[model samples]
Target chain A: MSLDKATVAHVAKLARIRVEESDLEPMAAELNNIMTWIEQLNEVDTDGVQPMTSVVESVLRQRSDDITDGGYADKVTQNAPASEASYFVVPKVVE
Target chain B: MNDFASRIIQGATGDWEMVIGLEVHAQVISNAKLFSGAATAFGAEPNSQVSLVDAAMPGMLPVINEKCVEQAVRTGLGLKARINTFSVFDRKNYFYPDLPQGYQISQYLQPVVGEGIITIDLPDGESREIGITRLHLEQDAGKSLHDQDPNSTYIDLNRSGVALMEIVSEPDMRSPEEAGAYLRKLRTILRYLGTCDGNMEEGSMRADVNVSVRRPGEEFGTRCEIKNVNSIRFVQQAIVYEAQRQVDILEEGGSIDQETRLFDANTGVTRSMRSKEEAHDYRYFPDPDLLPLTFTQEWVDSLMDTLPELPDAKKQRFIDDLGLPAYDAGVLVAEKETADFYEQVAEGRDAKIAANWVMGEFFSALNASSGDITQPPVSAGNLGGLIDLITDGTISGRIAKQVFEAMVESGKDAGTIVEEKGLKQVSDTGAIEAQVDEILAANGDKVEEYRGGKDKLFGFFVGQVMKATQGKANPKVVNEILRKKLDG
Candidate 1:
């Protein structure tokens, strides 16, 4: 449940967050406290209970397999930080 | 087990056994995306097929597509797998430009379909059963276009959230041929079920090939996955090259680094894409937006009942019941449309004759042109009629072949062609006798020589009679009358 400074730094890097070196110790301490408290909730002996990940208790309703919604590229790309030729543009990723 | 392990590449260290499995991603045949109402048709404009939920807009929820789930179940039944009554969907968290959602909705721990078996028809007329580990339902990612611009990468979300059935197989293959046969057989079954079109070139169907090498009876070596091999040929090449690479490494006292690799089709070699440490650690959890899928056994049974005869059963029937060669039966049942056409032609007729004509002249004619069985120029009824012309006394076998060529050219029925061309077999004894008299009168020397015990000259007289009748004379009657005329 506890996180060291290096582990906190790794978590920040994986989440794409820029955690400054000066703030790493405090961030690690805060994360450790939260993780400890969450671990307490796992100690309860609720062996027979089903795991519920969502508040909704019903199966998903299916929409009919039709092509009714489309051709709204302008509206879809309107909120993008940058767009070119009716497409969202992001930094190039090479693999 | 008469296994066709023909292509086992021998290494200096030992005879390395090739272990191969496939994870085939078949795009479901539903009209809409798996979780969104977006159109799932291929070849649409780049983003014109995207929905709000498909584009991963915040606060948007996903509604499962019922048709997709049904397709997955049907495919599972075709694979002879267990259709679990209750299964859950999960989120596989990853980041890529093509993926609009940072996490893809996939099944991890609980797939919709469990272990299935696919029967593979090997090269040596033997068959093997490959184990299917599981078949799960998932959403596809969008396509990223790198070549569209030199300075930037373009994203198309058309394929995002599209329904896909990820079928995973156990590592049961020992050679490249087995793996190739496995894909072909699986594709045939999927095409038969109408769940996937099984077109690898169109990206609708693709495979991730897993390859490992080992000594006989030894624990399995490390396996590296070659991702997105689009064709069966490439899959075989990848397995061969990857197995050899691992064997060389081990033979040289080098350990294999577990990794993900990519097959270079042009070079016929596999190169490491990424090592194991760099692999994406997909954090999988039950999808919060959807509920666990549940259905009764009745639903699965109903699907099974409606299922068409798969390739193996249909092929077996063609062999045992129809008495066809293993090769012809296989070629006929490779595609559903071809099998249906064969059935229509063979119905109530001599199936062996039907099989011969269908596989011989009919297949070659179709192959000569680039036409599919769906739109064959010669209909099944016409083909059956052609066979009937030979079966009955309407036309000789040679004359039927001539009529068949004419049918292909004109797209006319066999009977119509026979009547129009006046090519009916002259089975009338009087007509053949008259022709025989004329040929004897002209070939007086040959007739005399034939009576003088030159038995070969009798064949010359029959040839002349056929020439005079334009090859329409009944062969049996010609033989009988010519013998009587010559012997008398």
Candidate 2:
């Protein structure tokens, strides 16, 4: 699948990234190239083969429902650019 | 089928029927977050319950919580839904202040549970089966506090990564009442399973309502979703408002735009959400951090064995085994705590009597005190003891009510309250005969009237006898003595 500049711009917007308008065409071309390279795998006849979710054949590990972590609110928000009362602060999102 | 009057809006041009579906997000009742070992308790300090994994720290991985998966499967079993043996979690990519992970771990194509059905009882005493499209496990986002600051929002990651079961329903509900009943029934089942608390007010359970208007028997209309209706009543209200809004638009010859809307509780109206929220391209893909979840049918069967008798079965038992009226059984079994309390009271006692006492005075007292059946004013054994007093002729029903009121005022048992207040029924034949004799002697004219075809005055005589004994007289004994003296 080839990527268009508009599609690249939309993806960037969805990711909350501020992609410059001038760079959109180059980014789209790069993404298209990557998609083309990945599309090469589609040429192989792998019909009836089960899709694999992981490289390793292991089930997801599950932990019992127990509160073994937390209570370190200070360390959790310590690296935040803006925080107040252990809450990370961001611009208001009303919607 | 009989009582369902289509919840239709009579537009100026034509009639419009509402079609509603609800996606309820019930927080799993586990001790920890979905993937992190953080406390999942509500109302904690802003971020006191946040773990590094919950806050999305770099390189922190998520491990599945076993109890949450079990809960989802148990809920699926309760709903009589197909529990997919293999399911995969997907990343629902989005950006929001409350979502620290940039994407939510959810199930999209392969949900934990497949299609199921829940039976909803309407106010008209008719029941309908609403189809459950799917139920899936997902991580909840954090709490966002926008009004805490003038220009910024505060984010608490305590709720982030918390396990949630999003139970989606088919567009089977045709009325707002049906939607309300659907939520109530679903909540009851969840509470019964102990999978979720189903407390909508506490944010343990919430609903996203889908509403559309269509011509009777016509194709479905464009549906809009009203997000985060936290209460069942609000869900009903939102459906009504949203459906009417759609009908109004259609009636005006305008097409409806499918979008996300918000319900304003104060105004009882629904308005479109921001335009940006409408174009949600989640770009969902299987989460590579976690492998596919697979379990054997033996495991599912074991979980089913652990399932408690759900609301429907309990209600049926109350009806079939206990001979309770359907209404009373429905009322009692609506909440798991109430049903359990009723069962405790009814144990080894007359089921109908116990049911009456529970549904009548017990529930009344509970509501008056704004208390729930979980922590009722009277214990189950104590309530059973109270009912036993009436059954064993120890106290008349009238006096038992007095004893119950006293028990409520003072935290004493029925027997002790009966002893202190002298509220025991006077079943002694000698004492009742004397009271009857005296009443007859004083009210000679009424006694004659009673003997001379005025049988209604018999109640007056009984009342006098009871009053003379301070309402402690056994009603049957009083009636027998009065009948022997006056009628004979």
Candidate 3:
């Protein structure tokens, strides 16, 4: 897929990111090149191949479903930029 | 046609049918989070149960909790679904304050469990099947407590990364009552399997209700999803409101928009949260940090063997083997503890009588006193003993109610309470004869009036005799003796 300045700005807005007007063209052009490079794999001709989802051949490792850790609320929230009443506080989010 | 399926709205032009489906998120019954070893207990202080992995610290990888997978499989089997031997996890990218990570790890495109069937028992002695779309395992986001401050919101990540079984149902329900029944039946099965607590008020179980309205036999209308309805009653209300809203829009020649809505518990209305076009595009990709989950057929079978007799099977047994009426069987099997209590009381006794006492007196007593079955003030054995008293004519049915109240008050067995209080039925003819003679002598005017054809005085005579004996008189014996004396 190709990208344009307006589409790039729209995507950024949907992601809740503010994009500068001067940077949209460069970002869109860069994104288009990446997309085109990735699209080159369409030329390969294998029809019956299964998609490889992971590199590891092992089964998913599991742990017993027991409460082996926690009770460190102080440590967990210590790095929050703003915290109060044992909770991370942020500017009001409406819904 | 079923009556519940017939409940419809007479719109500006004609009748409309509501199509409803539910996506229920039931928290898995585990002590730890899904991918971390942190405690998953509810109502803890904010962030108290967070581990580094749940907090999304740098360089921390996820390890699946094996018991959670077992729970999901058992749930699938209980719902009569197909369990996949191979499944993968995909990350759904989004941004929210409660979500520590920018993306949520969910199973998309290929969920672990496939199609299943949930048979909902309609009130008209008919059944309807709501198809199960799919079930997937996903981690929960934390809570955003907005009421904590006016200018800021507080976040509690204690629930973050907790394992949940997201069960999606097909759009098969036609009315609000059907949706309610569907939720109740689903919850009952999950509770019986010990996979979920099914406590909606505690937020352990929640539903996302999708509602759409259309003219009968027309194409499906645009649907909206109501998010996080915590109670079954609220789910019912939300469906009704959202469906009516859609119908109103359609009747005005306005098209419905697919969107997300919120059910207002206070106003009993639904308000738009966002339109579908403005919704976040969740770019999903398989997480490279974890491997694909694979389990053998043997493992799934073993879990199947562990499932207790589910609600439908138990209900059938109660009806076929125990001869309980369909409605009574349904009521008794709504909860496992209640079903077990009914079985214990019904063992070798008159099953119909057992059903009556459990569904009638016992249930009302529990409701009146705000009691539960786990530690019932009146034990099942004692309840059975009370029923035995009435069955064997040791006490009349009227007298047994008083004895039952005494048992609840004193926690005494039926026989103990009868003997201690001298409340046994006075079946001895000689004893009843004496009380009958005294009542005949004292109520001379009434006896004359009765002989003068005041036929209703017979009940008065019986009442007096019963009152003299403290309601312990065998009703049949009292009627016979009083009839012989009063008629004379």
The number of the candidate with the highest TM-score is 2
DockQ order of candidates, top first: 2, 3, 1
Candidate scoring better on DockQ of 1 and 2? 2
Ranking of models by TM-score: 2, 3, 1
Q: How good is model 2 by TM-score?
A: 0.95
Residue-wise lDDT of candidate 2 within B116-160, one digit each (tens)?
999998877899999999999999999998889999999898999
Candidate 2 wrong stretches, greater than 4 Å: B1-6, B448-453
Model 3 ranges off by over 4 Å = A14-18, B1-6, B275-277, B437-460, B480-488
Better candidate number, 1 or 3, judged by lDDT: 3
Model 2, residue B123: C-alpha shift (Å): 2.2
State the weakest 10-residue window (summed lDDT) of model 1 chain B: B1-10
Q: How high a TM-score does candidate 1 get? A: 0.92
List the global CA lDDT of all models. 0.87, 0.90, 0.90
RMSD in Å for model 2: 2.4
Please give the ranking of all candidate structures by lDDT, highest first, separated by commas. Answer: 2, 3, 1
lDDT of 3 by residue, B1-488 (tens): 22334458888799998999999999999989899999888898788899989989889899999999999999999999989989989998778888898778889988899999999998878888999999999999999998989999999999999999999999999998899899999999999999999999999999999999888888888999999999988888888788888888888889987888899999889998864345457878898887888899999999888999999999999899988889999999999999998899988799999999888888878887756788876899999999999999999999998999999899999999999988899899999999899988999999999999989989999999999999999999999888777775
